[model samples]
Target: MVLDLITIGWRYTMDFRRPTTTAPAQTPEEAYRQLRSLADESALRNLGALYSMAVDDHDIDTVVAMFAEDGSFTRAGHTVQGHTALRDFYIGMMDRYVTTLHIPNSHVITVDDDTATGILTGQAELSLNGTLMMAAYRYDDRYARQDGRWVFAARTLKFMYVVPIEQMPTSFGDSKRIRWPETPYAEADLPEALPTWDSYKC
Candidate 1:
């Protein structure tokens, strides 16, 4: 589905810094290269927002289709790989969310020919068990061009904090911090080849 550009335009436009110089490219080849790079970067950034929208809408099919055939998604120690695994992951875990809003803060992507790496920061507000929670998170991603389109090769998410809306204190002065803890992926529930964030370069 085509996401509303206005929904994400503020972040995308501000984050993608076009070359300010009006100096003409030294050669036609250089001009073409610059244009190609810009296109790739735009596509990559759009993919990031699209992915979040898929999650928010509980559109797992679109999410899976956005990935390469062998792509993987990892977050909070749960890793799902390929279409089959992703379907299982979403059906059993992702679909449980009653409501969600994923607002992307920024996505900084570095493109290199057909391959790219990016870091994305965003806030996720979700309802669970009738309670609202907001999570500040980051995604470390790797992308590759497949069949003339950018697809996720791998995406790993790290959560900085998950704050309960009702219980959030007015201040945190000397208060103990709360954050997601590391847990090993359930071997019996997921594929054995689930990759880690460290395996990808960004």
Candidate 2:
């Protein structure tokens, strides 16, 4: 009889606790906004994927067209601006590599009105002068909605590390400093500083 009374008392205490309140229903405008945001994110991701493929295929024209007319690509502290300059840069870069493949590790995009920003991290394999070279890179990209399409307004490349396949050590120790390559252009054309340390280094 005592045990039964204790069980009943516990049940009565729980009954007085309030149930969780559900979130309010989203309004029509809120629903539409969320849908639009999703679409924009999808388009931005597609843009990055296309870029990787185009570069690996040595399709310079297609790659250049993916950017805005006034778009710019900055790499290794040097900035290439305008369609003409970007085309030349890609052509020269492709010439240096007989074959290449870029494997995207991850990408994330944040949308703001007609503009968006994204970061892409990837590993690249290149055959240069009969030697295989591997590189890890990150691109900080800015996108603008032009003519209802997402196009790159600016893309900045940060090379985490690049080493000949045979030269890569089994482990990256400390990784507090990085060995940055010299720019292909004159010193005047490069940025003041370049980031070398890994962003997610433990």
Candidate 3:
């Protein structure tokens, strides 16, 4: 049945082979290398979840430690580099919220030697200045192995929408979906704004 499926152009989606172009490892050394690669990929993907937990917990130290010493983070046009800058950035940002719960939904990672890149999507429920708000967002990440552990080399954050939870129903249909309290309404940075999204239109 499996061979018949393959003959009909149905590739095995459950294959655990890495670098898909290559065949399965035959020698023990080659097997070890493949295992190491998978381990690195797992660690890199976990970085996103670890970051979300640290941020929601207001743990600046753990958050900054996830990045390389000279790593950087970019969000909403502002970029902060190095551990000191990253530490300060999170400190100020977390202070604006009374509490937050970040849910990391999905992550896709590509590994090349000791470096990697990933895209992560998630949502968050926030208590900002006592007002309940929700956000849908994505992170574009770059990672490097340093001292035998994966760390973020750089990360860029983009928001699909951020609105008061009560406004969720109407927010997506509105042009300006970023509805932060006391701030002017602003456009979301996803879907319609993505190049592929525009190309797919009729």
Report the number of the highest-TM-score candidate. 3
Q: Sort by TM-score, best first: what order?
A: 3, 2, 1
Encode model 3's per-residue lDDT on 40-126: one tens digit a residue: 878876888888999998988999999999999988877899999998889988988889999998776768888877778899999
Model 1: how far is 30 from its true place, Å? 1.0
Order the numbered candidates by lDDT, best leading: 3, 2, 1
By TM-score, is 1 or 2 better? Answer: 2
Residue 58 in model 3: shift from native, Å? 1.4
Cα lDDT of all candidates, in order?
A: 0.69, 0.70, 0.81
- Model 2 scores a C-alpha lDDT of 0.70
Per-model TM-score, in order, reads 0.73, 0.74, 0.85
What is the lDDT for 102 in model 1? 93
Please list the residue runs of candidate 2 whose C-alpha ends up more than 4 Å from where it truly belongs after superposition.
1-25, 174-202
Instruction: Score candidate 1 by TM-score against the native.
Output: 0.73
After the best TM-score superposition of candidate 1, give how far the Cα of residue 20 lies from its true spot, in angstroms: 11
lDDT of 1: 0.69
Error of 3 at 186 (Å): 0.8
Top candidate on lDDT is 3
What TM-score does candidate 3 get on C-alpha atoms? 0.85
What is candidate 2's TM-score against the reference? Answer: 0.74
